[model samples]
Target: MSLQVIILAAGKGSRLGRALPKPLTELNDGRSIMQQQRDNIYEAFGRDVSITAVVGFKSEYIVDRFPEFNFVYNEQYDQTNTSKSLLRGLKASSKGGVLWMNGDVVFDPIVLKRAASIIARDQSMVTVNTSSVSDEEVKYTVDAEGFIKELSKTVRKGALGEAVGINYISSRDKAAFIHNLGVVHKDDYFEGGLELSIANNGVLMEPMDISDLYAVEVDFAEDLERANLFV
Candidate 1:
């Protein structure tokens, strides 16, 4: 099975308080976030995998930085959310299983490799990395069998797991899913669209618990500091 990787880097990332786009922000090691993510994908899937980046805010910066990878511009980035950004990326991706990921997080290459293995084994399955989350953040409720039951933003009464911003989706199903996604509320996030599809179509998502994986997502200055510590 062919594997394609799509990195969503179109957000303005106002929280980062940077002149450049979030993905272009430099890390402590001097490499930009986009470069780190691209390198991570390459390491995980080798050179065979087709990699594409969805660009919008600061698109020129991303194009200048990563000339090797194919880029799809999300013109409605400011008007829409991650779901639209994902739709733009999916439209540009090759017709096969894909490793869809968020660009803000720095992940271990092994996570991508593991997800690819699962997708290759079962095309119907979707993989989401689960990690212990704080009480203030949105968390996903998973059943005993590891299927996502609910993706809630409200603080739950019990334990909850956070999505690590990585996913493995079959392109055939993804296209159909995106088509159905158009019926959902426009302001809903990409995850919400997936949840809608899962609820109505019985699409099964397998959990890949990566609580042990060393990954950092740069959302604010504090997150950047935390990333330095982890890196």
Candidate 2:
């Protein structure tokens, strides 16, 4: 089976204040953020990958720009959060493991390169940046076994790092994850699903630290500025 990849781009990124979908927002390099992500995916996985984009909020803009990607639409985009959009993406994936990320994140292509070996082992994991941890970003903490214990923006007490919006669910854990994600509130981010899966189903995930590399989740204009610095 081909490697399955997902890009969650269903929100109207009002913070970035862009007329285009946030993923379609152009970087200093001239390629749109999603375009760069697509290029990087190709670089890491070669032509055998199956890329799926979950689109909403002027979906046409993204759809037209990347026709090569398979699409899953989130009709309730305005009212729902990443959990719902990601659930849709997960439901659309074929059997086997899947890697997913926020469409707006701009990162060094090597980030995906590093994930390749670990992914080949079929271990579920979330890429994290230990160098930065803030209330605004999704934070994570591990249990005694060092598997991720808590994951959310509200995490504070034992936060080890910020999730970089890139994550993988192994085939062994996919069904439980999909079910856990289905129970999350519509307003919750997908982190809630991971947490629920861990607690409710004992799914274990390692935190792959890529602190030395750059991965920016472009939530605002300032974030884009920082992302461009590394591009």
Candidate 3:
């Protein structure tokens, strides 16, 4: 099936303390983080993917910067979080398989390839990294059958590792997935909506281990520095 890619780039990235929005931060060889993601997706899926980017916090700059994408502006981005932006994007998404991603992450193209391979078969998935675990991470745990049991920042132990903030939903599950997202309060993270869908809606985003790949979400100033080095 054809795929639609939704990139959430609405936040101001205050923790990074950068003039550029987090998504537009130059990370690798002067290419912005979003550029890298777009390039990687193109390399992985080629013409099968269409991109819809949700932009806020200098929305015009982001829109103008990436004219190739279909843009949706989050008018209340200052008052909301990723979940709200994702809901908006879902309303704008076409009917197909969807790859949802955060804009702040920089990752190898192989990560997209790996995710695509898994999603093609299982239809729903979340990319995971078992190589690094931090107390502050939003960890995802799986039962023995490889089904996701929980996803939260508070889980301090027995987590495989952090979720890469990349998720896939098959076209068959689109309506239910949107319903799952819609029931969430605007204040909650997108993950909260996602968890709801898994428990009540049966939207199974099984964990796809990608510990061998290099990926990093640049949240803090130090994370940005580390991302540049890692990329």
Candidate 4:
């Protein structure tokens, strides 16, 4: 089946304190963060991959910039968070497995090559950065058989690392994920859905560690600097 990808770009990104959407923030190389993400997706999966970006805050700006993407507008973006935005994106995507990422992430293309193999096998997985474990980012711990168990910022006990923005859901698990995302409370991150699916639906998701490759979700000035060095 052809690849379907979703980018969750519906937030105001108030943390950055910028007028522009976080995804549109310009990198040192002159590419917007979303544009760089698009390039990375193309490099890994080719241009034919079907891409849908979920837009809400400043939707028109992102919509006009990337004419290549199919957009799903989240009307409640201002009142909600990633769980709601991602629910819309998943609903808009094809029935096949979908790969998605936070629009603000700047990642190396090599990461997606590994995703390709997992996507081929129709296995669900979340990409992780084993090197850093910050209190602010979503952290994770695997279950007994190596599937992701607990995933959230609250994970303080045995966090393997941060679940770096990028992730995949197989066709077999997509509906379950969608259901969980829908039931999650507003303001909950997308990780809440994943955790729910794992706990409630028996979905098994592997953690694909990518600490060796550079992937930074730009949330602040310091993160943008770190992302630029690798980009």
Q: Give the runs in model 2 whose Cα sits over 4 Å from its true position.
A: none
For candidate 3, write residues 112-201 as lDDT tens digits: 888877767747888888888787777888866788878878776678888888888777777777887778877777888778878887
lDDT of 1 by residue, 1-231 (tens): 446888889889999899888988888888887788888888876777687889899799888887888899988778877788888788777677677777888766677666666776655443334556765444677666767766545537554567677777665567666775576655656777667767887666666767777667678899888777655
Q: Model 1, stretches more than 4 Å misplaced?
A: 123-131, 155-159
Q: What is the C-alpha lDDT of each candidate?
A: 0.73, 0.94, 0.84, 0.92
Judge candidate 2 against the unseen true structure and give its global Cα lDDT, from 0 to 1. 0.94
Candidate 3 wrong stretches, greater than 4 Å: none
| Model 2 Cα lDDT, one tens digit per residue, 1-231 | 889999999999999998878999998999999999999999999987999999999999888988889999999999999999999999989899999999999999999999998899999999999998888999999999989999999997989989999999999999999998899899999999999999989999989999999999999889999999998
RMSD of each: 2.1, 0.7, 1.5, 0.8
lDDT leader: 2
Clashing pairs in 4: none
Using all chains and alpha carbons, the TM-scores for the candidates as numbered come to: 0.90, 0.99, 0.94, 0.98
Model 4 regions more than 4 Å off? none
lDDT of 4 by residue, 1-231 (tens): 679999999989988888978999999999999998898889999999999999988899998999989999998989998999999999888778999999889999899998889888999999999999999999999988999999999998998899998999999999999999999999999999999999999999999999999998988889999998987
Worst 10-residue lDDT window for candidate 3 reads 114-123
How well does model 4 score by local distance difference test? 0.92
Q: Which is the better candidate, 2 or 4, if ranked by lDDT?
A: 2
| Poorest lDDT segment (10 consecutive residues) of candidate 2 | 60-69
Relative to the true structure, candidate 4 reaches a TM of 0.98
